[model samples]
Every structure is written in structure tokens, then in C-alpha cells.
Target: MSRAQPPIAVLVALSAVGPLALNMFVPSMPGLAATFAADYGTVQLTLSLYLIGLAVSQLAYGPLSDRFGRRPLMLAGIGLFLVGTLIALLAQSIGMLIVGRLVQAIGGCAGLVLSRAAVRDLFDRERSASVIATITMVMVVAPMVAPLIGGYLDQWFGWRANFWLVGAFAVVVLGFAVPLLHETNHYRQPLPGLSGMIGSYAILLRSPVYRAHIALIGFASGAFFAFLGAAPFVVIDLMGHPPSDYGRWFALGAAGYMAGNFASSRLAVRVGLCRLIQAGMGFMAAGAALMLTLALAGQMTLLALFGPMAMIAIGNGLVLPSGNAGALSVDRRRAGAASGLSGFMQMGLGAGISTLAGHLVVDSALPLAAIMAVSVAISLLAFHALRRANRQARELAARTRPALPKAA
Candidate 1:
């Protein structure tokens, strides 16, 4: 086996790229709009398009990594990301900027998908979950500080500086990847044709264990994306916080998520993956329910909003690592397909929820809270279904196993 190169550090570096790529440009959104002379709605398309690119491209990256190997794909993706950053930096129009963002996303999705696959490559469920949690604990800082850093950059050197910074970051990651990262997909064999790829995915989809875990993670992720899409508008536009204050609020929620990840890392080994996920879903549900109630009562102040929001963030952090690790644990031989399918479902659901929440955003916090409640409730249901499936699997295995000899 290739030496596992400190999974926690690898994950931290990989996870950092995703949020940094997205959030570093968020503070510059208004400025970008003004520069392009576009409406706010049009400018928001940059974010939407990035998510679209990320979701769609992840499917290709996962299987390709499986077919070819992880290190080469990762290195090439980083190169592509750097190129995209350069394009964004030099873009003179909104359309060009959007194109660059899309390209960046295509490359960024590699880091996300492969990181999970790599974890699954090296570890089992509980250990993988712990590794993911530790990574999340460190990586959560990206979102917390990205906007703050972006804001300063926007104020100082204009929006193009953000892209330049991203380019530099990409180079740094590439440097690390060259020496530290190694191919971990020992089971992966070269596919001879399209039919082989299709068969791989089909086999993964047919597995009940994989489906349950993927669904749980997908819905749980949707809840967080719903919050992310709606929170800025609710906080800044409805709640009267200045745009500049958004970084602080974003940091608060990220801090809560970081705390949750830390807790999950510590607890997953002892509590078991299923129990930890169950507890997390319960917390998420409770938090969402409380937020919904407060919004309905018209008592959703900043403090009221962030308090329950923190709970949801924490719960999601706890659940995601376990859910992903469980899904990937089902088939070591097809971990890449499992990782691809799970990434597709997770990002697809996230995109849908973000879009729905964005459209449902009204003049109040009610819509956002309601969306979060629904997402969390769905995730809770998914977790229960997974539990039921696990029980059935255990029973089936018991029935199929040979009976022990009467005398030893």
C-alpha cells in the first residue's frame, strides 16, 4: 500500500480549495455586478453556474480517477483550476467571468470528489469518518475567512485580485500534490470501453447499502445548501446587516460547523458511525424545527436566527462525514463509482435546494427557515431508512451463514 500521507492534512488541503474558490469571490459579487453593469440577479448567476459546473463535472472526474488513478487526475485538475483563475483575472466582461468560474468549478470538483474517495481508499467507515471530521474541522476555516479576505482584496486591489489570489493558491496546492500525494486506487483497472464504465455505475446503484448512505448524505447536504443560498439575502437584505457584516455572520456559522466536525472526529470511534449520524440528524431536526417556529412567530432576529442555525451547522458537520464514509464502505472494489454517485447525488441535491431556497426567498426569514426544516426532516427520514436497511442486512447475513457446530 502507498503510505497514507497523513489523511487529515490531505483532506484539509483538499477541502480548503472548495470553499475558498467559491467564497473568496462572494464579497466581490456586488463589485462584479457594478463592473459588468449587470443586475444583482444576473450577477448571482455566477454562483449558480459554478454549482452547476461542479455537480455535472464531478461524475466524470470520479470514474476517470478510478480508471486512470487519483494523482494524475488531481494534478491535471489543479492545473485546469489555475488556468481558470487566470482567465477570470483577465476577463473583461461578465460572460467571460462566468465561463472562467465554470471552468474553475470543473477543476475544483476533482478535489472534493477525490478527497472523499481517497479517504475511502485508505480507511474503513469509522476511521474514514474520523478523518473526514478532522479535515472538516481544519477546512471549515476557508469559508469563515474567505469572504473577509476577499472583502479586503476587493477594497484594496479590485475584484481581479481575488482571482489572482486563487491562482496562487492553486499553484501552492499543486506543489503539495506533486510530492505528497500518491495514487491510492489499487483496485482500479483500466476500462476498455463505455460499457465498462456504465457497468461500474450500474453495479453501485444496484447496491442497497450504497443507496441508503448516499441518500442520507444527499439530503443532509441539501439542508446546508438551502441555508447558504438564503442566508445572505435574509441577513443582509431583510435583517439590515451591511454587506460587510456578512463575513462575520458567515464565520459564526462556520465556527459552529467546525466545532461539530471536531466533536464527530472525537466521537465516531466510540459511538459507531450509525449512532453518531442518528444523533446528528436528531440535532439537525430539532434545530430546524426551532428555527421554523421562531420565524413563524416573527421573532427571528439575528441572534435567534444564528442560534438554531449553529445547531443545524453542527449537526450537518457531524452527519456528513459518517454518511459519506458509510456509503463508500460498501464496495472497496468500486469505491470510485460509489464516490462518484454519492458526489453527484449530494451536489445535485444541494443545487436543487439552493435554487428552491433562492427562489422562495421573500421579505422575511420564514422562507429560509421553512426550507431548512424540510431539508432536515428529509435527512432524518433518510437516516432512519438506512438504519432499517442495515438491520435487514444483518438479519439476512445471519440467516445465510452456516450454523455453528454443536460441539467444539
Candidate 2:
């Protein structure tokens, strides 16, 4: 690892590309459907498939970056992002647009995976968690701000305007990244090939603590992705609200998430990861419960839809930084692989939930609310499992330790 750590701002910009591309174009989904004369399900593939691409590509990126170092892979990924964004901007058909999104996801995920690995390289567990928490706090701004820009761009210019802006943003981030980001991976382990990668992942999966952390990360994120998939359709198409209105309302959820991350950044080291995680999950569960109750009770206004989501966002913000730190800490030697696998689980579940929610939330937001509730429930169970596993390991260690000789 280079003694020089990259500035937090650079890391944020690098990481923000993925979320920016993901959220900025979301407000244009309805327009995309109208332009291509496709059904909503088909149009929704752009988001779901992009998520799947992020999931699958991270598997390779983590291991490859671990072996090759971070800077080069990150640059390559950003280059791919630029190319994909260009293709998307110029696409003539929905199929082409989906293809472009997949490419963008594959390339963009390089930054996401490497940035976390870089942090692990630079800091110990608690400190890394703190840093990641701070990074996420700032990074949340991208998704929160992106929708507003996306909505206005779509409304004022067209669907293509959003992609144009994304491309330009990527170019600027790329310019800064090339100069500032250096080799942060100081320890490079030998991964002979594909089998080595699989073996690394297997070792991580065998650990109950690691598995629990991944579960928490995956399902917690699933709640939000489900919302992203369904909310645009619910607000814009069904509720007959404009895209700008959807963007404005969506800011509430983003702000809540930012607040939660701010709390995590301050409290993670002091309060401990597990407590923070539990508290965050409590927020998530409550949010989902309230949302489902509202939907079942026939409260389908904008506040009813977005307000509970704000609560869920706060929970996610609290859980994610700690979850990532806990998982990466499991085997610091395999931090890259751990990061990759965790991201895979997170995005894979998200892709599935986003697609499912898009299909089910056609008539009402009840299905979306129900999905969030189930996801939050799973997250709570995962945190419980993590606590149990940690307790068992401690008990086993105590039993295994040799008895000390009595003092004379």
C-alpha cells in the first residue's frame, strides 16, 4: 500500500459514478417506455439488468484488483463507463439501451469494489468503518441529487439529455481520478486463477460471521432497490405526477439516509458495529411496517409512499458501512474477495427484488411495501445470526484456551 491515502473526495467521486448512473436515469423510465413502445416490465430491465451486471462483474473485479492493484482496474472500469454511457446516449432501441446499461454497470463497479478494498488496505476495521460511513454520507448526495437533475433533464430536453450529462460527469471524474488515485493495495496475495477465486469465496462463506454480514448488507439494500424499481411507476404513471414531482419527493428518503450515515460516521467507533446495526435494523423494520400498514389501509398519497421510505433509507445508511466493515474484516488478507462477494450478494438480491417489485406494483404500492418488510425482516435475522456466531466463537475460544497456572 502506498503510504499516501487518496483524498476522501476522490474516493467519493470514483464511487459516486455507479450510484449516479444508476439513479440519474431512473426518472426517465416512463419516457423510455413511451419512446420505445415497450411495456413497463421490458423497460424496467434497464435497471434490473444493470444491477445484475454490477453483481456479476464485481466477482472478477475484486480478485483481479487484489492481484493487479487498484488504480489500473479503476481506470479501465471508468473508461468502460464512458463508452457505455455514450452508447446509451445514442441508442436507437430499448435493447441497445439495456445493453449499454449492462456495460456501464460492469465498468462502473470497478470503482465501487476497489474503493472499499482501498479503504481496507489503508485502515483497521473500526477506522475503516468510520471512513466508509463518512464516504457514504457524502455519497448519498449523488443519488439524492441525481433524480432531481434527471427529472428536469428528461422534462426539459428528453431522455437522452440525462445520459449526456452522465457521460460528461464521468469524463470529469475520470480526469480527476487518473491524477489522484494511486496503488493502495500493498499486500497482494497469489490467486492462481479461477479456482483460487472460488476458493477464496468459499473460505469467506464458511465463516458464519461473514455470511451474516453479507446477508445484512444484501437484504438491507434489497429494500431500497425494490423501491427504486417500483416508485417511479407508482408516482409518475399511476399517481399522474410529473417526474419533477417524483424527484422532489424522493429527496426526503435521500436526506434521511444522509442523516443516518452522519450518525454512523460519528457513532460507529463509539457505539460499536453490532449495536448500530441492530438499531438501524429497528428503524428499517419500523419503516417497512408502517409503510405496509399505510398501503393496506388505502393511504397511497406521495407522502405515504415516500415518507416511510425515508425511514428505511436511514436504516440502510446505518447498516451498510458497518456491514461492509465487518465483512471485510473477516479475513483482511482476502478483503478484495470479500468485498466482491458481498457486493455480488447485495446487487444480485437487489436485481431480483427490483424486477419483482416492478412487476407487482402496477396497481398499488402495497406489493412494494410488502417486499420492503420482508427484506427488513431478513436483515434483522441476519444481524441476530451474526451476534450468535460471534458469541459461539467466543465461547469456543474460551473453552479451547489452556488454563493458567495458579500463583503460589
Please give the CA lDDT of all the candidate structures. Answer: 0.80, 0.92
What is the C-alpha lDDT profile of model 2 across 162-231, one tens digit per residue? 8888888889999999889988997788764988899999999999999999999999999999999999
Task: Assess candidate 1 and give its TM-score to the true structure.
Answer: 0.93
| Residue-pair clashes per candidate | 0, 1
For all predictions, the C-alpha RMSD in Å is: 2.1, 1.2
Q: Residue 355's C-alpha lDDT in candidate 1?
A: 72
The lDDT of model 1 is 0.80
lDDT of 2 at 25: 90
**Model 2 poorest 10 in a row by lDDT:** 1-10
For every model shown, what is its TM-score relative to the native structure? 0.93, 0.98
